[model samples]
Target: MEYYEGSFDSIVGDLVAGNRVPAVISDEEYGWIISISYPYKSESGELLGYVCADISMDSVVRDRQNYLLSTLLILAGVTAVFAVLYYVLFNYVFVRPIKRMSGAAAEFVSGGRDGEFSSSIATLSVRSRDELRLLCDSLKRMELNIREYVNNLREVTAEKERIGAELDVARHIQSSMLPCIFPAFPERREFDIYATMTPAKEVGGDFYDFFMVDERHLAIVMADVSGKGVPAALFMVIGKTLIKDHTTPGRDLGEVFGEVNRLLCESNSEGLFITAFEGVLDLGTGEFRFVNAGHEMPFIGRKNTFRAEKIRPGFVLAGMEEMRYRAGVLQLNEGDKLFEYTDGVTEATDAGNGLYGMERLERVLCAHGADTPQEICEAVKRDIDAFVKDAPQFDDITMLCLEFRQKTPGIKEEEQ
Candidate 1:
């Protein structure tokens, strides 16, 4: 009973004092042990020795540890059961639908271009009201729109190709309509004649023609219709045909244009008009009789060097009914060249928004004077090209050049 020192002493003191010890006390030798000791009393007021009971703290801690381990095992089993249930629920509720949408998307992308669209998404869409359903709706709308656009695009492309083919044939026909042959007057070489025309489009509105009306009169025509493309080309053909038809021997150049204008106005329903300049050069006397109907001034020279010939222009052809044209006479001496062109020459624009004005044309036309009519036309073309480098052609460019070699006695030029 007295094995423990201080704790036993306190119990004994309590018993001797006749007081009750209520608290557990610890001892070093017992590790984690506690004891309760109290005083014992006899019935005759006699004092008895101390009686105490002890319990070890080690057992309490062991019981606590065992309880904690059991609690943890129960919690672990519950947690495992709930984890399996949640996995199944999540896969059934969300993952399965998502996978279906994903598979549909992949299939549509792989075969969509062939005009095949998937209808499987609708099933999932009707089954749910979540974001997945909205995604399916959006995909359907997108593919439908794309399909419509693709169909429309195919139709437009085919139509464009057809129009392009027709225009090509038209361009060939238009080129053939004019006297595109280099040696325009091959056999009779009273003077050398060469002309060129370049349309801004595949088919242009500008046209040039040189043909002998008789043994003495060589008629040259340079005209520009009001517009471009098929309509302008049609009008150009009509105007060209009328001018050539009305132009016969013993007819005044101005009167010929007046008759042609009347014929064009008869069918000018589109209100389209033409600016024309035509001249008849007398091979015998070297006298050129020309008429200008609101056309650009001609450049007069033998070679590349030239000057603008001033003229009082009449109203444009088909502008009004029964408008009279005025004729002008200019003598083309031997070795003298007459260059005629449309507005496309002086009115050319550059990339800098600069007009290739008449000043530039004169300067370029006067430089590097060549001997032949063909060389004169080509030199001016090259100069215009160089001046307007990389700039798009805005209008039809047409040029005609003729050199008078002699009067009554025609001089032969080397075939060029």
Candidate 2:
């Protein structure tokens, strides 16, 4: 009875307290609280404990959860609608047309024939004034232009090949005009001679020749025309012919050059000129009579010593109508050698633009002074080839060497 009264009293006291509320706190796994308040009344308006009520918040929490779920469902439905529209619009507006054009371009590059583009693919109708449309138009035009351009290119290439073949034939003919067989007139034991020419291109203006005017006289000639290629080659042919025609046994070297110069000047076209050296050797006497027309000085070698011979200069042939050349005479002893060449031989260039000049040529001759004419020529060629290894020969390289030997006392003479 006391315990029940105490509990009731405590409840009534809490309710009576001014502005106080009764609360039940329960410990569950998460915990919970329930609170209630009641007004109290007494006699003459004095306060007294009355009644109270309380409830837990579990039902309100469940309603809030239901509201959140509804909101999520609405958002997911909206997203699905947007996704379906986006995929359909994207496929229609972008993907299909691009795939078609890509296929067409691939086919075109892989040697597809004209009008072979797939016709089943429809032209894109989603036209906007943007870069993609312009790109497609440009591609189509480029395809057409490429086909025409390639056809034109083939024709041009074929024409070029034809012209190249003709030029090769011309080059061969020009080479044949030169005397390639060495040691010409080898049976004449008095001297040995050798010459060579390497043109800068298919044909060149430099030339050399040696032939006997008679049993006692040998005519040697070397010349360079003013230019290169076919025009110069033609001039070279004319100049070579005139020089050989005028040089004969018992004829003066100066007169031979003078006559040739006048003849060249009369028919000179294209303003061509030639630097030349012509010599007539008396095999029996070892006497050399030579004329120079603006040519480089010749080197004379005897007994392993070589030196340049100073000769009077005359005007280059074909420059003037009445040019006269004077002859210079030098006595060559037995075992003496003479070297003559066009400027091209000394002017051959390396990649560094250095000239194979007179100094180097002289050094070459001096170094190989004891070698025969054939050997000397070979030595010079080898040195130049080494000096300008892998470099293009920039000019016509030509050289001639003549060696005099004394006739034996008992040797029988052969009739010419």
Candidate 3:
């Protein structure tokens, strides 16, 4: 029954090579079998005798099929595990953070700038310790910055509106202080008078007025105060009041200015000063007596010709105490025009940086051909516009004009 005797030599050959030998044998009891012989080695790898085992042909085929099935099942299980892990990584690292940021941005936009729902921007949980976390931090910071900017803009707009309202009120009060009514000195047949004051974009202190001191003498004033805005306006009120009060029936022109100057210097805490021209015209004899306080020269027009007068200028009022002013006299015949203005008129600038000086003013006056005071003023203003078109107004322009008609007939009594 022992079957190892026939294959002993070949088994030894296989063992020497340290390999397995497989052989087919026919046995009467087993009916066709396969024999496998393997070498046995000691701990030092020294080969010993071979060991042989026999299996029936049918059983060998069955074992091979079972092994194939088990291998396929194990491989499928491992692939499924990897697929789940890949999905988790993609969702956490890329998809989830993007979705959360998109949602947050949408909500922030749909809500108003001051909406309380903006806090959701900071509540996102994209803490992957990677780009997702960095993106979250940046989004939160941007939201905070936007909100802060909105708040600051609101504050600035409100402050601007408040200041604008106050300026509007101030502008109204300043306009009221001047003589704005057209055809000033109505019901006076001896002369025709008109005056205008245009303020700068910022409020300015320039004023003009003409009033009858008595039945025959007309007082005319043109003045400009230092600086601008509310302070200049308040100072203008004081100056205007002082000038009117000191011009009485018996008061001299220079002496009136002298007293006003003293009073102004005492109250000028801001060191402000005024350049002014005050003149009184006698209706009967056509004598014009005037005093200038460092102001611009007046223009006289006769028979369609205009010329600047050669009169001396004195120190500005409120500049020094006890400043003395002198009166100058000029004779204005019938149909003669006297024009006075602040520096703003001559200093008007165009976009080309050119000044509207005395030459242009004289040309404009002559071009008018001896119009009424109102028409002359309008005509000159048109010329100035043509010269300085589209230029930003740099200063306040004030102009006063008066035309002398024939002397009052049989008015020897009105002169008193």
Q: Write the per-residue lDDT of candidate 3 for residues 1-416, one digit (tens) a residue.
A: 33442433546665668876656455455565766677788999888767877777666556877788888888888888888888898887899889989999888877754444366787887768887888899999988897888778778989988988888888888888788887776677889888988888446888777788998789999999998777887888899899998988757889989999999999999989999999999888899999999999999988868899988899999999999999899999989999999888888889999999999988888888568888888887887788889998777888988999877677766553
lDDT of 1 at 295: 92
Estimate, for each residue in 295-350, the C-alpha lDDT of model 1 and write its tens digit: 99998975446889889899999999899998999988878888889999888788
At residue 286, candidate 2 shows an lDDT of 75
**TM-score attained by model 3:** 0.72
> How do these models rank on TM-score, best leading?
1, 2, 3
Error of 3 at 253 (Å): 1.8
- Ranking, lDDT, top scorer first: 3, 1, 2
Each candidate: RMSD: 6.6, 7.4, 9.9
What local lDDT score does residue 38 receive in model 3, on the 0 to 100 scale?
71
Clashes of each: 1, 1, 0
State how far residue 364 of model 1 sits from its true place (Å). 2.2
Candidate 1: worst-modelled 10 consecutive residues by lDDT: 407-416
Judged by whole-model lDDT over C-alpha atoms, candidate 3 comes out at: 0.84
User: Which of the two candidates, 2 or 3, achieves a greater lDDT against the reference?
Assistant: 3
Full-model lDDT for every candidate: 0.83, 0.79, 0.84
Worst 10 residues of 2 by lDDT: 1-10
Which residue ranges in model 1 land beyond 4 Å of their true spot?
1-126, 302-304, 410-416
